[model samples]
Target: MGSGISKARRGLLYISYNGKVQKFMFDRKATSRDIQEQLAISCGLTRLSNVILKCRGDVIAISPSMPNNTPQEPYTLEQAGYNVSANDIIASTVKEIGKQFRQAFMVEETKREVYNRVASIESRVEKDGKRLMEMEKYKLDLVELRDAIYNKQTNTLDYNRLRPAITLPNHFYCPSTEQESLISMARDIPAYNKYVLTNETKEALKTPQFDVWQWEPNEMLILLEEMYFELGLVDELDIHPATLKRFLLRVQENYRNNPFHNFRHCFCVTQMMYVLIHGCRLQEVLSKRDICVLLTACICHDLDHPGFNNTYQINSRSELAVRYNDMSPLENHHCAVSFKILSSPECNIFANLTPEEFKEVRGDMIILILATDMARHAEILDAFKQKLDNFDYSSEDHLNTLKMILIKACDISNECRPIQVSEGWVECLMEEYFHQSDQEKKECLPVAPFMDRDRVTKPTAQIGFIKYVLLPLFEALNKLYPEVEFIALESLKQALNHYERMKDFDENKKKLFAGPVMSKSGRDWYSEKQMVDEGGQ
Candidate 1:
């Protein structure tokens, strides 16, 4: 073959055989059949009929225009997109099988196997493409639904006026007699060792002014139990007091020792929710079941907080972010931990609920807990605001939105407390912020401006948070429930003013201390020091 083909006609081809690749020379005008005949002869085959040719793992027939059994003109190297002059090696494989019956059968079976694998891969790709299309369609459907309800272009909500008013379900009502007995039963149930609920403590627990720092851990646990009992949740939900206590203990234990997002903070939020539920007269507006959901959601909202915010979790690419796909990672972990504790039969406070009831409560609790994520703060607040003017206690949509706002209100109600209490919480929050900022520095991640210790002061931090974020929320709540003005809104305003004064004092103090310094020469100390300094010499 080398003597027959001229140097210009010689072309390089790489053939893979028996798990090894070898180079071979062929004529540029040689067809695949001629190359196969040469390879068969080199392999000691008596006839070319015994050799099967494959290119790039696919079987290549001897003839291009017809079957191998038929006689027709075959494609040359150039016709197959191979440039021999450019030394482009055409990758081919030679699967040698004798003309024996078993060898031919095996070759045919191998071809079927390759075809089957290709078909399988194609099927999977098709299925995955279909699923992606379906997901895209579902996302578009939600967008369409949102536009139908509220058209952003016109700033109009067409569905707002279309919703018919609804009435509270009969089961949602709490009987006065039953509630009184339930309170008595809850109070009478001994919760902790040597801890008694005195009149002062009971009264304090009823108000948002209840100081979590004042009570011992055991005392706080008892108080948490009392709130659930006092709200008639234990009796109405048929939760055994021991079961409720176990659940409370589990919740308290799950909360890590973070600076601000700790068990004490959890207690504070739950107590605030309790105060809101009573002070706002929400029980008359909502059902007993709804109250239960509110209190429970507050208790489990910050469970297992790691002292780090969601931003850090996402930016760090933590295990939590991977597990929850980077959407509200910490919040999602909180929900997971909450349900995990509830999964234990001994700590299952809602065990008495039917499957349907449990499912609804579980869903509501997740929604409320997830709502506490600050990323969704604006969305939740705006939704509540839109529903506020025509707020209906009977409408489920309106009621759930209110429940969301209620939990959110309680969650951040620390500033709405007495100045002393709110100030203490501010310190705790700043500590947590600084801790996270330090970690961000160590990890070389972007630090939040408000969290940067070098950039923030107590007064500067509280001013914007209260003015922009806290005030509008509380003021809006005050419109629907006038009691909020007395309970929390006033306190928030006072807190804002107190911080502003402190800010002013800080500025003046800076100016006072920043005055021209006097020296022994009665000149500016900085100027005198510079004169005497070595650099001045």
Candidate 2:
């Protein structure tokens, strides 16, 4: 029992030589002398007790009775004869560790692959959505192009003769592509091509062919195509391809003569309609369908006008005016003629519309066409302003917004059109008005404003018309459509400038007519007159 070794008030040691086991119990406080005394007796090293005590805390102290056997040597845990080295141990552990790390890396790689695959799928879905949107946009563009072409062809058609045929290709086509294709196809129709080429030459030459050349059906179609292609791009309004082709054919049959409602006028109106729709941002107010209907109305609003106003027809007691009771007589006749043509099974451009949609479209068409009467312009604008002021735009019912803006925009579209286009229209209208004036003069009837045949130019009347009528109407429209303000302002400015220039002309004329020769020196003339008066007396 290692001489019952004990450390003074610090620790106690117990050694069992029989079992080769040792036990130690530490004290909370012990001195170095206690450990020296215990080790000296327990290890039987009295002579080297001091040396053993010096190494005490450095090495684990064992009682001599607990460790009297030979020192045990360490052996490899693996098969000893197999000659396993420290490097082998390290290599084996590294391989196991590497295997775990590789497994973890594989899991991370798999997760990354899955994540990448999901991302690829999401990207594809986004691309597909964009492609679908683009396809829909193209379809709409195609529809609009088709409608424009149809309206142009229809207005050019001669109603008295055979109806012009407009063949629409079924395949998807862009306007530019279709135009190029049509130009190529034109070559096959030799007579049609010759007529178009000749007409083109005449226009280029600025020849007076209006009264001389009769408009052929194919020639009319070609012109329609040209006008349809010329209008700027519009996104919202979409005209059905079939409807457009059929409408053109019907128009050709309905207005065969070079009537007052010619294709050129329709083209101008259609172009104006596009400007109004886009320039006003009317899409914010109106539906795409409503816009389409409005455009259609613009094209056919003055159809079969007979180159005369209601007043003329009423004064002449024309059958059509009499039949319609002389109230918007020309407009009424035009609407009836257009709707009648539309009612025909073969001429129904709006055939594809549902009953409700058709009703709305027909109603909108009637409203717009009737509103085009210059006499109604003031009343219509008043009503439009009242609606604009009273109506709440935030209301859930967007229909009112649609009606108000569409009607207002159409009524004043001419004021916002390009200067060149507006000027062209003014000239055409002036020519028409003058022609009516001439007829009225021959009949000994009262001439109205521009319709006065005796008037040299009626520039004052022109200025008055723009200042009082056109400017006010456009100013109201500009409030609703700010983008068109610049255009309308420019147009008004140009018109007013022209009026001022014309007024100056009138002033200069007065000065020329009232020459200095007409008046002698004031005092000298009076003196000469006095002598003649005295002689007479």
Candidate 3:
């Protein structure tokens, strides 16, 4: 190491690429080239040709071939106009990278999906072309026969003729082999269990880990199928694993490429919901139907969120708010869009269930999904609090109240996870908040508090949120389910303490940045103190 070169900051370096976040850290003596090589590896890029490093809209890439393993001259953090702190976001502008990559990939994937779907539909048309006419004839003949028989013999119409009143005897609307091949992918379940489930480095079930960066949307179907298998819900619920995979693929496809509210967030929330369910043994309290709905709702709770809050929707007079009459518009949209996906022939994972069962599941799913509305937070919180006021474990309403509370907790449980995970989600949320703020500014609407990135907030705001919002919610939960919330509450307390310290540091930093400090000789109080002090050396 040269005298001029210094050690780089050793902390978590989160690499966001193609809608996937990979966690890594640079070596202390890492040069610019080292960073490039590490970044390439961390982002799962095969070659460095396409990789571009940007900071605040400025390109940082200097050469076509980035440094391999060769050690090079060290670059100063100061030279790069950055600070090497204990907890630093080295790639501060990585959100833009994620956004750009997601847009590009989404476009390409959308084209592929559209092409496949069109081809499948065409193939179906070609195959069902004959049956289509037959179905039409059958429908026409039945209508005509029924009309003539009823007209001729009024009440004495022969029931024998109408015995086989089948409208399209075959399910022609069902998915063809081509469509099924597109929708479903056979998974190596044993590999998933061995690699993801059994691995020590992977996050343990119900045991929160520092890694909260969502698994890539590309890997969602496999992970979801494995999740379904791990919970034994496939056999219990009588859902074929292939149907579940199809359902998941459709759901994931529909999720918009928003920074925070994408399919990755859905997986994250579903992961949290899994922890809550098994950790609290809510399954023992609630029926399998309720449990299934709870988990499923977590998956579909934020489908197609447009990266705007309810207030923005109402103020902008968005169609969603208008359609829902300003009553949990996003929640309603999520439920409706999700159920519509489920209703598709290829994606109907719940098709095996009876009509009553399906209805109950959908109804419960809607209730649970709608419960994620922040406006209903206070209402749900108060209602649950009232339940806590008069505790009853056996009551069905009480159980549902608890379910609502758990789902709400899981929805925002990003903070309840390990600190690294917590920080990752906070960054994600802040990015989303800043985007909303930018939109609000463009629309001439009042920017929401703590949303605008220009007006920086101290850790005080986070501390307040954890204390005021999450603390009470988790506390109430902990009272009912003792050990279930201990880990989460402790993490919250730790975060609170951290923010409190950061608040003091921010105050001091503000003082330094505010103005020039007054010298002792410049102050009249100095002379007064000297005169008051006896035997001052």
Candidate 4:
């Protein structure tokens, strides 16, 4: 027979040498000499003959009288009473082979004991390894949960506050309350008039024609505070003017410098809300608390916007989406940041409000902010339309619906501005839209048809949006307040006419250059736009 056997004839054996145990496979019929030679080569030993192989702490011996079992005979492992199937350790020591023989009665006991012990040890080791891996994975998960849900340093979830406090604007430093009070006192003087707006600016701000593009950031900040004062919110809400200034400053600080959804868009929306309140005479009709809620919601509606819409958040499975479970993630974030600012003692403009009042305001603000999500446009418009026919201002439900419609109207009211002003906003919106589309292309996500700059022209972009979204919303609001038709609806209609003319010009230009016509696919584009807009922000 050959010294080596096929895999099927090989059985496992454990070997203990140099204080370490290792597994080895041996032929089932391998003799002591064959094993000794193989081990010597495998273990890098220079000599093999002098090695003593022990089973169960005694030397393996063959009786001299046994056939082929003389003291020098090469006996198979089974002849020495070792079961290759048991995979028992063959303990070897580097010494002369001993002449001792284990009694016959002990052989069976030793084989069974070795098998049980080896099997037990291996089973335990495998189970322990798996347990260790599981425990390690669990530890990592706990640490992640702890970090995400709690502040490690504070060891508490500071749910009310956002970390790394809002940055103070230029020309302002972190001032002590004493200093702030003194500044407020000085500002109360008529001579300290730098923050005051011109009569023309104030009057202009009261109308829809107020041009946001004409103001600088600092000027806009002052305008916002002045608007709050002009609305009597500062007095009715018991807002400390100094505290209000700080809050507005922090609000400005939080808005990112995106192409469109930055501080300017925020101011424009709030200004439009102001225009709506006055244009519709809502100040006389709506409660003071309701007007306060409307204005505050408009101010903080798009706080800290990252410029990407909800569709991207959901599609990309972004952190914000995961944080809010993909339900109006941006709107939820806006509310969180808004309240985060409010939670700060220095910026808590609503501090004078009772707990119940604060809760009511917070809830209303959340509703208004979330209503700005374009996906809810049709739902909110329909609900408002339903209420307009009954039009009971005394009904809490009807009043709340009007507040929602007002904020929604103001949020997208750029189209209601004068043509020159509205055109500038369209450019800004286009820039932001194109940026998002470009990112979608880079990330291999579906780009919104209207946002794809290559597929859409300026006129095409605004035309469908005006026809489908803006006119319907404002026209509904006009039903409740006929005065709004002249104030805002006229501007919207003029803007629509201007874009229509521009669309014709664009088509003519395309015809002159032999460019592909978009009118052929106009219906498809508008349909896809509505679907995506509903699914998107």
Clashes of each: 0, 6, 0, 1
Query: What is the model-wide C-alpha lDDT for candidate 2?
Result: 0.55
lDDT of all the models against the reference? 0.76, 0.55, 0.69, 0.75
Off by over 4 Å in 1: 1-193, 517-537
lDDT of 4 by residue, 419-451 (tens): 888888788778878877888999999888988
Each prediction's RMSD over C-alphas, in Å, is 30.4, 27.9, 30.6, 32.8
lDDT of 3 by residue, 1-537 (tens): 433423343533444456454555555455665666556655555423235554445555533233322112221111232223522454556767888999999999999999999999997887589678878989999787777557354676666543212211211111332323222323213323333444542246556552546555656556656666667677778887657767886777656566677787888788777777767777777777677777788888987677778888888877777778998888887887777778776677678889999998887788888888888888888888888867787887887788888888888887777776777667777777887888889989988788888884648568878988899999988888886556578888888888889889988976654433344445455444554575454
Leading candidate by lDDT = 1
lDDT of 4 at 127: 77
Residue 427 of model 1 has an lDDT of 88
Rank candidates by lDDT, best first. Answer: 1, 4, 3, 2
Superposition error at 333 for model 4 (Å) = 0.4
Model 3 residue 532 CA deviation (Å) reads 33
Q: Write candidate 2's Cα lDDT for 1-537 as tens digits.
A: 543435443344443322343443434244544544454444443422342311222343433322222113211111112233765899999999999999999999999999999999998998789789979989998776656555455665343332121122222112333422321211122222343345554343221112212445556555444333333212222344444555665554444233234665564455455555555665577566665666667667766556667788888777766677878877776677678667756556677778887887787788667767777766666766765555555663335434544554554444344344455555555666777788888887767866665664646766776788777776776666676566466767776786679789998987654553356567356445655777733
TM-score for every candidate vs. truth? 0.62, 0.51, 0.61, 0.61
